[model samples]
Target: MKVRHYILLVLVLFTGTLFAADIRFTASVSKTEVGTGEPFEITFSVNANIERFGAPAFNGFQVVSGPNQSSSMTSINGNTSMSMSLSYDLVGVKEGEYTIGPATIVAGGKTYHSNAVKIKVVKGRAVQQNTQSPSAGGNAPAVSSAPSADLSKSLFIKAVASKTNVYQGEQITVSYKLYTSVNLVDNALDKLPDFNGFWSQEIKNNSQRVDWTIENYKGVSYHVATLKQIILFPERSGNLVLDPLSMTFLVRRAVASNDIFDQMFGGGSYQDEKYKASSAPVTIHVKPLPENGKPADFQGAVGTFAIQTAVDKSSLKANEALNYTVKVTGAGNLKLLNAPKMNFPEGMEKYDPKVTDNILESEKGVTGSREYKFLLIPRKEGNYTIAPMKFSYFNPATQRYMSLSSEPYTIKVAKGDPGTNVTAFSGANEQEANLLKKDIAGIKTGAPDLYKDEEAFYGSVGYWLLILIGPLAFIGARLFRKQQAENNKDQVKLKWKNANKIAAKHLAIAGKQLQAGDKKAFYEAVYKGLYGYLSDKLNISAADLNQQNIAEQLQLRQVDAVLISRLTDTLNLCEMARYAPVTGISEQEVFDKARSIINDIETHA
Candidate 1:
């Protein structure tokens, strides 16, 4: 009876597990084809309770009203189940084919992404762009045909640069501020400016929360949030255009009373409308640094700085360690400054300097100091003098180049132990032998030992061990051959076993291509590596495999959703880079990401 009970309990648990794994979270649209200005419904529903849900960005459509949460519970024959859904009413705003990306949800302590939905928008009847409607005609106020103009003026992002005209390598500040008069229901950043042709340093606040304040722009009061603050230094001289920052905002707009109760109470209702706000592109006119007064040794530093040098000790024994430091203190692109040149006397070994920065950024500008420490070793005893260090920078504030000279350092080196070995500097090959004195003794002077065998080779221990190796080798070879034969019997299993090797071979090719500066071949090899890995590991044919089935197969194997997503993204990037123009992600980066995804899949799945 106990055995039967255990068996029954095990069966019940197994069935419950299967049922739990059957949770279906899917996205469906009312119409796959529609006309421009026609509104449609898209619903994301799941059979099980979810913890978090994220709606996909509606790129080519305007959300009239969205994400209405509805839940229902049912019980039949003592079995209860619950389901929830979030639906959005979106209208096509552009006449083109578009795809709505996947929506994500967290359930059962795991996240899942729904399949993408595609929509085709064609020309439709002209719709009036009215912003208001009479409430007496209907319970709800009709949505305007055009929401961009209405929401753009209320909620938008403004990219503000401190100064547009400046010399190359001059420091400037650019801030992307979100100004809003309407209540923001939700928001997400779409794209950040690439900021090409410039070196950018973003100012990060201590807190993750946005600091909101009331600000009046163009005589209109609005709540503003500084989204991103960046400090940029132009790398070249041209009319460089600062790309726009794009974001999507769900705004709550005051609409006519949508309910009979609200209409009777003389109250207004609000509708959540989705609108995308892209900051206007700002052009910065960068001027070349003046060449007339520029110093010959200037290292492209455009800032005001003060240099100070110090030596740890002016006198030291030969082969002793010495610490020399150079510090530059002041503000204006201190982070961009290069290492100052040092002129140490002969017979001393100098090393690369260790750089340290103490920088602070504020509204006024960047202000801080940078320090470089150099390590030196004197090998011979003599009186040596280090030339006075010189650092020149083009100060945009003064509109001229200036140079600073540090006091010279004179050192007296006393001889120590002759056994100490100091490597020669530069190409002094003849002096190298004298400088390199090893502490250990030279090669053995006596002749090598050679003796006749004391015992017969037939009965020695080595002879017995060697005799045993022949039988062991034969047995090992036999077993390996048999195992290979069995593996060959099942081609599928062989492919599965060799999946990792095949991917690695392709990755090796991709690495070679990356070093050779072959973008096309590099991307192709990376794409093949990832896809071939998936094909062999998942038993899916490469030609027939698409993103949808790949995702499904990975999920069936119980791979983590996040890892699957990463694999998909890498595959997409590799494929896209093969044909289209992919920026911000380099070929090496794509290769690394692909290799990492394959490794992770092997590790986890």
Candidate 2:
């Protein structure tokens, strides 16, 4: 009886060990490759129950649906088996190879890991046969019994250009349109073409909602909407290719749900299917301007343009400045066209031109006028004729060279004092004037007594002190002036050096406002403080500052991506708070965050 019991106990121990060793945790994906807009499922499965679960960081993808959990237990004969799975639906935001890291789960006071998975996101949706079912995996819900609709036939994007062949610097408009025959829940742009050899500007769409209209394409009626309009000007002469534009649309289609609970609770019997569409690449032939009639002084101005000139006053006294305005009006490349060269008479000093552009960018291309104001100052008394200034450009429409000239003006100047010139007498005159006011004694001709000279030179401490301090003072002054000169020359470096102090001053004022319970004033102060700090630190203009530009500038400085992302987030938060009403956020919290961001930037930058 004892021997039989020992044998039975040993067999029972062996069986327990075998069952324990069968515990396994693994991860899998519905598909290894997916479209940028399409959603895919990731499942973490184990044969045992977990106490805690930790997910991996999905860096390049956005989470669409969440931690759906399912478990099952089965008994076959005398053996029992159990399984649990956690699944997530995710959508790729960009096209690249991404790695989903291992997920951790705790079971029986021990941690278990799921294997990592790699996924490839292509530019467009995967091609599917008409007979194949659209439902990918068991985790996906089925909404109908019918097969999935044809995505390529139901949805598409078309890129159309106004002109394919154009001269360099001529304007071309490209329109991106979307046509669909199915119901679309939402759509988002995945990729915007980088016009490498062209200057491109987006024409803003005022209406936020997409206005769909019925249109016919290839004898098929479909709903169409204009997605975007871009105005591009080729910068070089060559066969330039415009890259393809890509977008993703979330489509709702009929599918049969196998789960009775899902079918009962869910209002509709449809599943969301993501479809991607890309426009065809376009080729443009940019031709160089004809050199036969190209003017030597051509300002690279293309398209039809006209020049108008006026002077604030045709006649002015000597040393007085006169405003001479040159306005160029019409369409095409107004921002890029160089200012017309002006030739003023001798004795008339001309400062740099102050250029102002009133160009309105639209589908018709850049239109409006750019005015160049030349401030001319007469230095001496004279009667001089200001010769006519000429501007030359090639008009692609006319297929010929065009020139516009400003009318000549005669100026009369009266005499002015010579001393009015700021550069006339600088350091030399000041030094001579100081020296002339002092009286000078006659030079000593006879030699002094040797003992007296020794007592004054060697025995006196004051003489040695003067000798030691004189050169040191001169050297210090010289170094100080040199440093001042350098600081004046490098304005960017100077601003960067003082950026922290300036930011601190602004923050201090913000703190005061926060203490006084002025919400609006506090937010405004914080916004200005942060903006000023970025402007000074990055040496960028306040008017031209933006999130995209800021990130680019930080990248150029070799700042880490995480730090740059934090800076961007902080700026965006401050901007939103400035315009919107303050709700749950505290002013002190914002102030602290701004301060922290500045400190981090200073440490890293």
Candidate 3:
């Protein structure tokens, strides 16, 4: 009788499980055809109750409008179920027919997929204009149609340089302006262009809406916008290319209608307009300075500038050194532009110069000066002559190159003082240093013999006793904690307690590599995706580590051997590829291998 009762209970539970799994879910898109830069909506809905829902990854399209969610519960004849829906306003990049989605979600221990919907996005209908004037109210009078103010017709970017022609190493102020005559709702800026081969400075970044004013551009008046401005210093003397900066903005187009109300609201229709405006990649005719006229010490710098020299102190003791400041201040790419070459006097020790810049922007463009501070020390006591300095740059406004020079200064020497110089200056305070050194040497150094009378038992029972007790004590404490947790009956609390241990143990190996600058090791551990699987995975600091630290951190994370080895190899290759002596086919092969290892570890681990 008891056996039959157990069998009956088992059968009832199996039936319940099957009944719970019977819930079904389905979702599909309305249409798939889309025009370039047109907004469309995609919906994901479920037909049955779900414990949780999620959206699938949408790779190609951007969610411009929404991920609006809705939930509803309906009851019919005392039977009830709930459904959830999610929708997004998406935009395609180009005109095409696309398989919108089979969006998926996992809930109630089962996976559900939405229907795969196809969409065709074709070119939009032609816009028609109404020629009736507003004054022709009662008796409509025909008026010849003319294009109104449409900002969409002329949206562009312009690169305005202070001067297109310059000598080598001269500074050029480049400003990017966005001009549009179209009505706009919103616009998104794309990725910025790379200013390669030029030492550039971001002097101004406009983050506020520019107050627009009417300006006559080439005999036509239009509303103009100033987007970005920068100061560029030409590093290499050649025809360097400046790439185009592109952006996408919502362009508002008015709908032409005979009805005044329709023209007001439906004219509010908007479309995404991509603006790829840039000035022609400028070709500056860079002129090289004449060989005979150029100064032998000239370091290829050409610009208009002036210089001044000053000394912090003219009189100093024998061992003491004084500061000599040679300042060159003027306007001409002062940020990108380098100052004249400074020559250190004979027998003077100098460290790296501490550079400081204070630049501001104006209608004249970015103007600033760089100050180089040098820390100098004199070798011996003597008078020194600091030579006069010179600087040169081409003035874009004047269309000619200019130069600046500073006057020379002299220094006097006397007896040394400790405060004036760190090295070479010896005073009466030197005796205090000797007394402290003697005191430090007069101390005992040896391990203490605290256990002299205790019995030393090795390779005996006592050694084994200690080794066994250590693990036993740990096990006892763990078991006690487990028992306490079970009594409390808190699963989430228990998960939190053990999470760090498991995470740290797994991340130990990787953590070591991360600290040691091992890029391969760092990325490999990050790719492991263990953090998503095991709660106790180590918390690895992924910042500021070089390739060597990356590998060592992996070991520190205590990652498994197979993963660690692969990580180390990948890290080493990344480092080598970045700083390798030879750059060719082998470098590409190594990079490919590293990427493969990263993906393999991510998926398999």
Candidate 4:
């Protein structure tokens, strides 16, 4: 009887487990019919442990709040079940029928998709604001019943610029603020200014919630919040129009009623309505930099700037790599400026510069340093003077062209190994050239061992070993020849196969340098390792390799975006550490991160 009872208990638990473990992925919506410019909710849920999720494209909707995550777990008889969901609050921007595409999620090594949903939006009736509310001039709130034409004065968007008139390539700060005298339930961006003919950078707001403060605008109290701040630089001289910023807001207003049931059950009724607000178009008069005052070396740089040129090694072997960095520090259109043109005296191989930006964008404007790192390799031994690089920019504040010159760099190149030609090897760095020199066979020295032809010839162990070696060497040579032939067929494949191995070699050297407390050598090895790996994996020549190129190639290969960003950051960090003392990160950590980046690329590539 006890055995039968145990069997029954097992059966019951098994049934429950089967029921709880049933998995499903589905999409659900709050409502099918939504008024145009009104907001709604759509949620995608999966009854499994999710590894990653991809959101569907809402073609006609603007995302107000999105991808809010929630998870749940339940345990029955020690058998656990899991479920997770991602929801987005979206607003329809157009009056049309639209289909929300299927969303994808990865679970248990397989991808699952949720069903698509369709929604229809139609023109909505305008919301009415029941007159004026001058807070502190306190007026009781009234319910909105019908469309009111005076709603624009209650809630509006304003675009304020620091200066309406500015010179081309000069910096301008523009702030978009929201002025609302009435309450708002929900809001989403409808349209943002394109800022055409200008290079623009936004001041990023990190907070999730909008902090509103009470302010008096035009002698009326309203809640104000800055929505977006942008720093602009006119790319060309002319009249440029800044497009208006627009938003759709769900407004909550009180509705009065005289019905007996309403009076007995509640004091009043409230209604939620849809409303739209837009800022007025703004125009800026951009004047060209005065031709008479402009310096010949001006590279379209506008603002106050200082330039400094630094070379890591004044004297290095011909095959060794040299770091020539140009740092431009100041406020202005740094992003618009091009690389300073400089002539590298003949015999030097200059690769594309690795640009590093440490700029900060805020309401104050964009300011920081931009570093251009050039990896210069000298092929022939000689004395080279890279003329003092002259950087000039039009200073709007001073109304004059300012010129700054970096100390001229003197490079003396010594002869390297005759066998080591840096131009022939794209990935060769300083350490690599040394390794290449070591790889060349040299003459044997102090050889004294000799054996006479005697009894040691036949039937001896040495004789048998020598006799066997002929066949062994022949086999080894044949295998090597076959592999080399295959490698010669596709150079890309060859590089791909050897990329990780080469990266590992550089990392080994970096590790040694880290232990030896050599910051310069350590960072150089790390930088080379990362670049070498990318050169091999992406089939990009070392000469044309840069962060942008690496990102484009990796993205073409369908590699993960986050991994590409991580690799780029590692390269930047190594470059920065070579110049300045890196804080908050140890050499060991940097080494590990470089290795991990290589490993991750190998895994994903």
Candidate 5:
């Protein structure tokens, strides 16, 4: 019996060791060396079922095709084997040596890692002589008899700049274009260029479809279309480099075949091929503006501009308000231009000017006008003069600083009527003045005539009644005070009182998350803000809050239908944005919407 038990134990141990030995994980690549624009493949293989997989970040490379997965199981004799792999196709952007990081996988309650791979990228074309296999998980042609087409000759991207050299804060237009000779079925931008040391504004097209035109380049006629256009303003003086723009295209190619079997099976001699193209990096030389002859009022304006000033009324009462308007019109960085300062006469009070920008941006640059309106109130009656307003800007065309001045204005002020009292105080002082005036006017008038009764005694009914009512009023006041103290201790009432303050704190957190580009955390914060606000305001538990329940509760509070609908929609969006793919909705837009809903609820609910 003891020998049989030992044999069973030995078999169990042997089987466990064999299973452990069968588990294998590794990473492999199709090639270790390639040209700058040539494509390559990397694959990760595992022998056991995987519960999760984390892909490595492929820095300095653009992914052309994604994580294509395949699995298979084979059995021979009395043994069985299973294998799975994840593959990716990538293209290099620049010539350099790069390392592909290791990938991690979790299987059978154990973690596994693949080895890192090193690759060398050089200049020149790395010709792929053999056709790619059909199971390589790509959209390219499976088989072809003729050699592959030269990508540089068939398709390419060009970067054109309106000005290669510019002064700091000057506007320059850069456009990316696509030129192709082959038939293209689909195209998409894989990566956008980094515009370092510059502020960029995209010029949006009204229509989605691009207008293609025929163009001649290098003695060849190719169809060309503008892919993107942007207006860039250099933030500093230096040789700023615009990184290359990467894109992928699906080209339709005609396959050549001579086999009779190919024709008999109707294997159409046409296939869709995948290719990638990139624009050359562009260098911009930015020169600083000349300090000589620069105006003292120059506030970083780098364009031609004209300033005009006008007073609404030349003559007005001393205590009346007048509008002093300064309008600036012309082109070049209008949004960044500061408001020109004005010199007003002494004893004249002026408030901060309200600025309005009616600006439009295009490929040519920023255009339109900005208006500044100042409210002036004269304290004493006199003739006042507002000095000429000066605006200085650097003109790139003329390569010199220019200044624009507006005509001076003279205003006549007369003392206001004493009967119509005009106090210089603001807010509560004005209210207090009216109250005091009314009280004085009432005292100046004689008191009303009095009628006395014939009988006057301490035991009269009216006197006794007044004495009894006073004690009863005091008792009622004490009870009301006690009730108010108890209500102050209630947790629900406390939360309701501070609901807005709490919501504001959460919204502030959400703003930080948005600025950091943390989509998941941002949405979560917004959700918490809305939920916590509504629960506290309505005295509802957080667990019981939902779209339907919130709507019902808001309706009970007599909230407006439009406001309720907005709240519901905003909450739904917050929930969906947590898991949905990133959309065109901007972080600012979400923040503004959430803020508006909360304000509306506070006002109407």
Candidate 6:
């Protein structure tokens, strides 16, 4: 009886083992060994009731195409089971023998893995070509909700600039153009690049819809549209990079469906596909203008231009004011060009000139007119000549220095009011004037006006009370609103308000770890805590905080240079200790340095 019981127990245990391991995963490759530049498929077939599934990270080989997924469910013997599969087309960028991983996924609260496989990629193909690959994690093609046609192979974009090299403060115009050889069904923007290290002004964009023109590019005819235009002025002389612009478009393609019979029955189907591409980034080398041959009146203006002046009334009464208008207009650096200074005669009271800009940007360059209106009041009646206004600019097209001067204007003033008479006081010297007023006594003290000083009101009490209370009430209300905002602040608001304070707390924790001789934990704590603090303080993501990005952002915020360098050095030291495994740095030294760095950054930032 005991032997029988043992046999039954063994059978039960074996059956349970099979039942527990029911979830199965199988993987297969289209070709195990292929020549270089050859494409093949790797499919992972999952046969189980999967509640959730995740893909494995692919390394060592490029993914030419992606995980096109197909799933199905089947019912057999009143028992249901689901199956799903994903296939990827991969290409080898380099020849090597690579071992793929035992990829794992979780299903039904249990982890299942696919078997490891070896692949041999050989070189010496007939054709030399570059391989295209999908991005990591097998991101699928983006689909658009709007109905549109595909323009992947027919349309493209390019950016054109007026000049690559320019002096500091000189203007440069950059225009984005779209060239289309085929009709576009629809297009939309994916991302807009950032403009760094320059002052930028958007001159034209989609907001202003202009007519499209048919133009020939590289001897090929196409419809061109000016997508965007900007006028940029470099603040510093260096290599300024203009980032790339990307867009996604949906396009329609005609595909043959079924057979002749289906076409006759009007059963043909058309499909729309989407493609995304980015324009190449442009780098410009800005050369500073030579200071040796520089003109003193050169206000950093470049390109060819013209200046003109017109007077509303050249002849007028002595006391009456006349308008002298100067309009400077032409194509070139209009915004950077400076207006000529006006020279007024003695005894003329001239108010500030009202200057207005009416500039428009085009593919050629920046074109505009600057009008300077000067109001001149002549003190004496005589014939006075106002010198011509001069404007100077460097003509890049002509490759020479060009200047323009308006013709001088003569104003005739007749004798009028004694205040405006120049001859009346021409012969009288300052000494004579002092002698004539020698007998006049200086200002004398006098009693105040008693009746004017007294307040006038029908009801003194009400008027004085209202006058004193209105301003007080307004002050009290403002104070109450400020208190309410402070009291109602949530955690996010409080974090932003005292971000530096919280960062100091974490830095202190890192310092303690350093004191305990925990070098690895110390560096990890300092780097992560400090960076995380900055992310919270600056409201930036950790993924985007590289050295250039951090420096650019902090410099724009007017952060001090010493603090920036200290923070950069501290981060570098942490990385070196982790990666290089050089002579181990002292924990106490790094701790103090980290504390000081954080303090300095917070103080300056």
Candidates in order, TM-scores: namely 0.51, 0.48, 0.43, 0.49, 0.48, 0.42
In model 4, how many backbone clashes occur?
2
In order, the Cα lDDT scores of the candidates are: 0.76, 0.74, 0.53, 0.76, 0.75, 0.65
lDDT by residue for model 5 over 1-605, one digit each (tens)? Answer: 57679999999999899767656888898889977657788889998656568999988776755565544333222123456788887766678999999999866447788899998888854422222221121232232222245767768888999998999989999999888777666666677875756766666443323567779999977777777787888766778887788888777777757878887886657678888999998999999889899887777889888888889999988778789999989988776665565668997877656677797878788789988888788878899999988888999999999988888888999987665334343423333466457653444566755667556756798888988999999999999999988888888879888899989989998998888886666876887799889989988874455566789999998999988888876786675554332354787898999999999889886
Candidate 2 overall lDDT versus native: 0.74
- Cα lDDT of model 4 by residue, 1-605, tens digit: 57679999999999898755556889999889988546678989987766458898888776655555544333322234566777886766678899998999866446778899999998873322221112211222332333445568888899999989999878999999888766666666777776756656666543324566778888987777777788887766778788899888777776778888888887787788889989998999999789897786665788889988899999988878888999999998865556777678887877666667798887778899988888888887889899888888888998899888878878899988876673454644455566467665888798666766886567988989999999999999999999989768998998899999999999998888788887766887898788888889899875456676899988887889988878877786785554334555888888888888888878877
**Please, what are the lDDT tens digits per residue for candidate 2 over residues 1-605?**
57679999999999898766666989999899988657788989998755568999988876654565544333222123456778887777788999999999866547888899999998964322211111221112322222355778767888899999999989999988877777666666678776756766666543223466778899977777777787888866878887888987677876667888878887446778877889999999999888898886785788888988888886666777688889999988776665566668887866656667687868787799988887777778889888888988788888899988879988887877665543222223343355445636679887753544555477478788978898999999999999899778989998999999999998998898789886656766777788788889998875446566678888888888988877776675564443233444677888898899899889878
Q: Once model 6 is optimally superposed onto the true structure by TM-score, how far is the C-alpha of residue 115 displaced, in angstroms?
A: 70
The list of candidate 5 runs beyond 4 A from truth reads 1-149, 259-268, 419-605
RMSD of each: 22.8, 28.9, 24.1, 21.9, 28.1, 30.0
Ranking by lDDT: 4, 1, 5, 2, 6, 3
What TM-score should be assigned to candidate 6? 0.42
Candidate 2 residues lying further than 4 Å off, grouped into runs, are 1-149, 255-268, 417-605
Across residues 51-80, which tens digit of lDDT does each residue of candidate 1 receive? Answer: 568899999886654455544333322233
Candidate 3 C-alpha lDDT tens digits along 1-605:
57679999999999898776556555555446766445567777775644345666665565543355544333322233455667775555545566655777655436777677776767753211221111111122222222333333465667778777776556677777656565544555564545544545544322112445556777866555655566666554556667666666545444456777767665433344434444446555555444544444444444455666677877666645456665656665554433345676786655444456676756565555667655556655778777777765555446554556777777666656655444432232343355345553556687754544346676678888988999999999999999987866965555545654443443554455456655444434433323322322223232222334444655665556677676555444332222112222343344345445544543443
RMSD of 3: 24.1
Q: Model 2 — which ten-residue stretch has the worst lDDT?
A: 130-139
Tens digit of lDDT per residue, candidate 6, span 336-415?
44445667777564555656779886655567887887767776779888889877777655545666788998889876
Please provide the root mean square deviation of candidate 6 (C-alpha atoms, Å).
30.0
By TM-score, is 3 or 6 better?
3
lDDT of 6: 0.65
For residue 147, give model 3's deviation from the true position in Å. 8.0
